[model samples]
Target: MEQLTTSLDVMFILLGAILVLFMHAGFAFLEVGTVQHKNQVNALVKIMTDLGVSTVAYFFIGYGVAYGVFLGFNLDGQLTQAMTEKSGYELVKFFFLMTFAAAIPAIVSGGIAERARFYPVLLATFLTVAFIYPFFEGMAWNGNLGMQSWLETSYGAPFHDFAGSIVVHAVGGWIALAAIIVLGSRTGRYDSNGNMRHVYPPSSIPFLALGAWILSVGWFGFNVMSAQAIEGIQGLVAMNSLMAMVGGIIAATFVGDKDPGFIHNGPLAGLVAICAGSDVVSPLGALVIGLVAGALFVKAFTWTQKNLKIDDVLGVWPLHGLCGVWGAIAVGIFGSTALGGLGGVSMMSQILGTLAGVAVALIGGFLVYILVDKLMGLRMSDEDQYEGADLSIHKIHANPPKEEF
Candidate 1:
């Protein structure tokens, strides 16, 4: 029975890891569809490379920092124990979590697309995955540095993020925002007087929609399999994810004035918002959260582009950062028994935790980008930007012309 149970657990988490790993393709396609025609190849290449870099960083440093397991030493001993008594559960768990860690750079890639130098961005990916992201991840998830203890002592409960709303999505979003600011607008994106000179539309709405659909489907595994064990799985998490996704779609369609980008991104906004409280919130509360997140993405994305001049190509700050914060906070409001939820959360704790995550992300993001900028520069030159990253950096276009015979 013990052997059977262990095998089942390993298989469950391994499947989840594979599903989340596939979401990287979603991230790549989303960016590819959103970026300009000439930059699409770079977008695809950047996400894949960032994943490779993030995996190495996490395997060496990030996982140990967050969970205190050094895989380097005693590798044979660890593997022997893992395969025999533990059924390799720990190894598969690392795979599952590494996918989450890698998502940080994938998110940042969308924001910094079009003009970022390739190697510098990879360097930034290593720094954040190896140090910055895991630091907060340790605090929130692993109770490292006594942060979770302090929160529970003062606020009555530890910060309740069933999944990584603040930890992964918000951190990625804020980091992307900082990188975008440091890299500045893509060449001709703005004019001398700070007026918007050009509007860059999505290169392929179909691809964008496809990416969103892939993410939405894989999110079931992202949220439900977060239980990490077969015994801990809950149908509630799956149902809530579904409700939130539907709500986001309806709200975005109504609020975005029929814009396809807004419509496609709506479900993602909702999923981001519901990640924190998916296990605790009622389906109705999840729906409300999704609705708010969807509308918020549309409004915030528009406002930031027009007024703040952030120039985030995919509105990552809105979809991930802002919606992620809302998701964490909504746990306090909607996860209460008073609101037909499972309860055991407080708004104060959520606020403090969310603020801590944002602070870490912003400071760490700026620091990484600044250091990389000083060391090797962050952005491509104007000439490179005008030529687009596809040809300038990768030496290939997304769509090549036929040869003239």
Candidate 2:
């Protein structure tokens, strides 16, 4: 029986890891499709760099900080054996965490696209995934000081994020925000008159659509695979994820001015919004949350661009950060034992906890980005911006123009 449990846990974790891994391709295509032709290769480079950095950093330190050091489970006490006895599981956890590490920085690329220096972005990715993110993941999920106190004193159940709304998506969003502030807008994203210019991505609509579908598929593992134990409502998590995505698609497609972009972004928003409570929310609740998330995402993106003067190259802030916040709070509002038989801390308390998580993420992200900007210079030169990052940085030409003949 014990072996069976262990096998199931490993299988679920592996499945989730694979799902999250696929999101890389999703991000690659999505980002490349959303940016200008001049910046497409730069976007691809960032994604690929993030993949390498995530794998290495998470294995070395991030995994331990997130699930090992912070969990406070002494193998010496539990197994009466040396630390070597636990190295295998620890390694597995590290691989799992690499996906998350990769994801946060991938979010940042969209915010700083077209002008950010490649090496600087790489440095920022390392710092974020290795140190900045691990701190929050430790506190929130690893039963460290924050989760322990919340669970013991406030009756919270270990800061129940079935996947990672606040942990991964929101953290990534906050980092992206900071990077944008430091890196500034693209060369012509905002004009001398302080009016924002619309810079269309160089890729086709089909690319964005395909990327969205890939993300939707990957999200099943991102949410359900976190169940870790088959008995721990893995099926419920999967169901909620599916229902919310559908609801998000429906709302995104028809809710706005019938914009296809909004429709395309809906599933991503829905996935982010439902991430926090995927294991606990009922299918109906997930649907409602997804719909709200989809609508809110469209509104937030439009508002941020039109009113706030904040330019997100691929709309990462709306789809991930803002929607992630909504999903985190949704746990507080709809997380009831009776609703789906998966309850954690009280809804109100979870709300506070979610806010606290956001606070930590935002503050940490800001500080890290500021330091990176100061130390290494985050953005490229004006000449580089005009010439395009692909040519200036990589000395590569844009995709050859189609031949009319």
Candidate 3:
């Protein structure tokens, strides 16, 4: 039975890893559908390349940084040990978490699409996946540097992020914010008088909607598979995710005045918010969280474009960053026994942890991007931007003119 259990655990996590890995496709299609037609190929290419770069970075360096398990080029030895010890559970676990690590670049790709230089962005992905992200990931999940212990000792409870609300989503969003600031707004996105001189609408709504649906479906694995074992799975998590998704759709539909973009992204906002507390919060609490996140995304996305002039093309900061913070904090509020939850959470710990994540993401992202800019530059040339990334960077348009006979 023990051997059977180990094998089952390995199979479970492996499946979870594959499901979460599929989420990358959702990320690619989402970006492809959102960006202008000229930049669609660039979007697809970035997600794929970023995934490749992130995998290498995490396998070689970030896994060590986060969990003190450096691969150090010992592939055969590592696999042998992993197989003997619990049927390679650790290896499959790595695959699952590596997908999460890859998501940082995926999120940033959306915000900085169209105008970022290709190789520079790849460099950023390497540095971030191999270093910055793992630093906080170590703290939140692995108790690295005793941060989680200190939080629990001081606050009566450790921060509770069952999945990766603050660690992945918020960190990605804030890092994207830093990259956006460094890259500046896309050319002609705004006039010298701070007026909107150009508007880039979605190139394909069907593709966008398809991407959202894929993400929404795959998110169950992203959340539920964080359990890492079949016995740990809960129907509650699935139900709560569903409630939050629908709640977000309803709220964004009403608040965004039935905008298709908002409607599709609404469920994503909710899923992002619920990730931190899916296990603890009641379905109703999850719904409320979703509603708030949906409304917040619409409002903040519009406000940033108009007031702050941040050219976050997909509103990643609002959808991921702000909603992720809310998810972390909401765990304390709605996860308490007083609120029909399982309890054992602290608001102060949640706030502190969330703030720590934000600070690290912003500062680390800015420093990395700035250093990369100084070293090799980060933005496409004006001529390149006008020509579009598909043609300028990748040497191919998303849809080339038919060849002459």
Which candidate number would show the highest lDDT if scored against the true structure? 3
Candidate 2: segments with Cα more than 4 A from true spot = 69-87, 155-158, 337-342, 401-405
- Which residue runs of candidate 3 sit more than 4 Å off their true CA positions? 75-80
| Candidate 3: pairs in clash | none
Best of the two (1, 2) by lDDT = 1
Candidate 2 Cα RMSD (Å): 3.5
Among all windows of ten consecutive residues in candidate 3, which has the lowest summed lDDT? Answer: 71-80
Candidate 2 lDDT trough over 10 residues, lowest sum: 78-87
Using TM-score as the measure, name the better of candidate 1 and candidate 2: 1
Question: Which lDDT tens digits does candidate 1 get at residues 90-173?
Answer: 889889999999999999998888889999999999999999999999999999999889989999988989888899999999
Model 3 C-alpha lDDT per residue in residues 273-352, reported as the tens digit of each score? 99999999999999999999999899999999999999999999999999999899999999999999999999999999
**Deviating ranges (above 4 Å) for candidate 1:** 73-80
Q: Candidates' lDDT values, in order?
A: 0.92, 0.78, 0.93
Clashing pairs in 2: 34-201, 35-201, 35-202
Return the lDDT, model 3, position 64. 83
